[model samples]
Target: MTWQSHLIVMPIVLPLVTAAVLLLFDERNRRLKMAINVISVVLQIAIAIELMIMAIEKAPEPMVYLIGDWPAPFGIVLVLDRLAALMLVLTSVLGLASLSFALANWYKASPNFHTIFQLLLMGLNGAFLTGDLFNLFVFFEVMLAASYGLALHGSGVARVKAGMHYIVINLVASSLFLIGVSLIYGVTGTLNMADLAQRIPDVAAQDRMLLETGAAILGIAFLIKAGMWPLNFWLTPTYSAAAAPVAAIFAVMTKVGIYVLLRLSPLMFGISSGASYGFGNHWLYFGGMVTLTFGLIGVVASQAMGRLASYSILVSSGTLLAAIGSGNTAMTAAALFYMVSSTLTIAAFFLLIELVERGQDAAANVLAVTMEAYGDEEDEEEEEEVGTLLPATLAVLGLCFAICAILLIGLPPFSGFIAKFVILSAILNGNHIAPNTAAGIDPSSWVLVGLILLSGLSALIAMTRTGIRTFWASLEGNVPRVLVREIVPVGALLLVCLSLTFAAGPVMRYMEATAHYLHTPEQYIQSVINTPRVGGKTENGK
Candidate 1:
């Protein structure tokens, strides 16, 4: 393989290798561990960016690596395409931000923090790159195991309770995952996704029922992880109870489920599937709408900023699921843009909430009481100040909060607005609609449009209330004492969101190309299934 081709596996390998090495280090070696973790994540980000460029320019076709030079259906394979590379970059960015936040004493609070974090990233990268169902399951377990450790880190009674629920729920999902994979493999005689896709159409009629039954079970597992409503009552509480940095890194964890759906749905049940065409799209659409509604309710009802951030994750996931279900190229492209914007925005908010809420409870209580009694705290005298000065910490936190509100509420002059605008416009314009959905800007589209607008309003109201209580209406607000390391990570993440607003054109084009490739998976199928095996030999040893 060429140098560029070799980079395909580095996302998984580099993290696994780093995690193993970090395990050998003493817990007290803080300075060295910090330096190594920083360098490792930075290099991971650099590699991810390079691989994305390669996917876009050097190889639009996936770069497939056959382990041990074995044939396609028999060997373990890693495939890198535009979507996978984009996800890798997203994970690396989140990892870097979360790690920086951890360096502000969260790492020191927990033993083996660096090791577990790296292992989490290793699992995430592996899940994105792996070419088969079994390896995906393996990576899922790796990620869930590390997350179990991280979720309970800096343990408290609340943390322990939430983490237990988190652990139990995911353990059940993993069991369901195993059962589903077993059933599918039993019917298809292959664990490889591409191979399964190729053979699914030819399965015997008696077994096709079993195949879809397995697929449905698998979909339930993914939906649970994605925090779909009804199945996801555990997410908000669990995430809210996690430490700041752990919560931030978890911003990408929900996306892992969305990524699987996006990757496999089309390949496994696309137009080529005949009887199985649009198998799960209907459930995805309705379930996503319901999830979005529940998320909005939670957002409006949330009193704490952490809970708000957690619900925002559900909102983001639901939006993506609905868009994917719609199967509109333009909407899906816009959803991809929104996914990046929302994940970065929420991750920053999680970190920022820790800083902003520091030592401000007394003032927040006073403001809440004042508003409850008088309905408004400001008088004309106080409202007309011309040269009021704000504390530096308060100013920074307020600015961060404002940016987050704009992003969360889909306000103008940010990527969030741009993304939603693109999606709503696509739906209104009737470019495409999913099967069973209404035609020509029908009731379902109208319902989605109304829900999107309402969800933003709900978020806006919630953030407005929270901001006023914490920053504006408070009688004696404390200027949060934030460290440079912590603040910088939050700033960096928000700035990336800002950059997305500026670079929407190029970014949207890339997403459009990605959506195009995803909808038409023939190229991916051919690339994976027909690739030369190990030792440069074809399956027939030609």
Candidate 2:
């Protein structure tokens, strides 16, 4: 195998090794550990970028790396394609930003914070790259295990309470994952995704119902993780309660579920899969619409910025789910673009929330709400109006908050607007709905478009309300003592969102290609199953 081939596995191995090395150090040696953690993440980002370039330039087919030189359907494999590479780069970037923010002080919340963080990255990268369902379960557990620690890292009442819920919900999801995998294996006699895709079309009539039943159970498990409505009651509380940096990294964690759904739906249940074509799509579409509506309600109702940010995540997930369920190539591409834009925006917002709230009291939100709802009757003493210069730190925070609001609201001049525009356009122009035609747009498509627009407006209202309370209403409030480290990560994340705006053309092209590739899974299947083992020898010495 070439060196580029070897890079496919480095994302997983690098973090695994770094976490092990971190265990050797004493908790007192925090600076060293932090340095090591940052360096490792930087390397991960570099490697991920290189792999992305390789995926785009050198690889027209999915790059497969066999573990122990074992061939497909028999041994573990990592498959790197345009989509997987994009996810790797996204994970690494979020990791670096979150870790940088944590180093400022959050890392001190737990001695093993850095260690657990690396494991989380390893798990995320593995989940994206793995080519088998069983290993996907294994990686899901690893990611969730690390998240449990991160969620409860600071050991606060709220954090612990929410952490326990998070743990329980994920544990149940994991159980369903295993059960589904076992059913699939029993019916198909294969756990490898590529093999399963190849066999799904021919699944015997006797077992077709069983296969789909297992698939439905598996979809439920992923939907819970994706924070789909009804299944997502735990998401808001858990995410809102997590530490700022931890929550920031977690902005991408939910996407893992979305990614798997996107990967499997087309590969295993596309038009080629006789009886199973487009299975569960209606659920995804309608369920996503409900999730989006629920999230919009939460966004408007949220009293805390943390909860608002968490709800925004649901909004992003719901949009992606709906887009994927539509099964339109254009919509999927647009969704991918929105996914990247929204994740970065939300991550920055999560990190920014901590910084913004640093100077405010615990009851500040409640006080603001109470004052707004009722009347703050006080002695009427009119004082001469005086203009005070905004402190530099507060100014930066306010500006960052405004940018986040704009992005979240899908306002103009950012990638968020571009993403939403494309998505709306795609929905209007979808196969079922022809633009400027006698049929007009379908009712479902119209509902989706309206919901998306309403969600954006709702986000604007929520963010504007929160911003006024936090920054404008509290003019006399103490300026938050923001560190360069914390602020820099938030800035970096927003800067990335801006970069996406400037590079939207190229980025959209890549996403379109990825969506096309996903829609056509035959290439992926053949590549994974037909790739020769090392030394050009199979287990049977063929």
Residue-wise C-alpha lDDT for candidate 2, range 1-542, written one tens digit per residue? 77778999999999999999999999999999988999999999999999999899855688889998888989999999999999999999999999999888889887788899999999999999999999999899999999999999897899999999999999999989988998999999999999999999999999999999999999999999999999999999999999999999999999999999999999999879998999988889888999999999999999899999999999999999999888888989999999999999999999999999999887766777998899689868878559868889989999999999999999989889999999998898765222335767767888999999999999999999989988888834889899998899999999999999899999999999999999999999999998887867547967
How does residue 101 of candidate 1 score in lDDT? 94
lDDT of each: 0.88, 0.92
**Model 1 spans with C-alpha error above 4 angstroms:** 362-388, 431-439, 537-542
Model 2 residue 209 CA deviation in Å: 0.9
Against the correct fold, how does model 1 do in TM-score?
0.95
Candidate 2 error regions (>4 Å)? 379-381, 432-438, 538-542
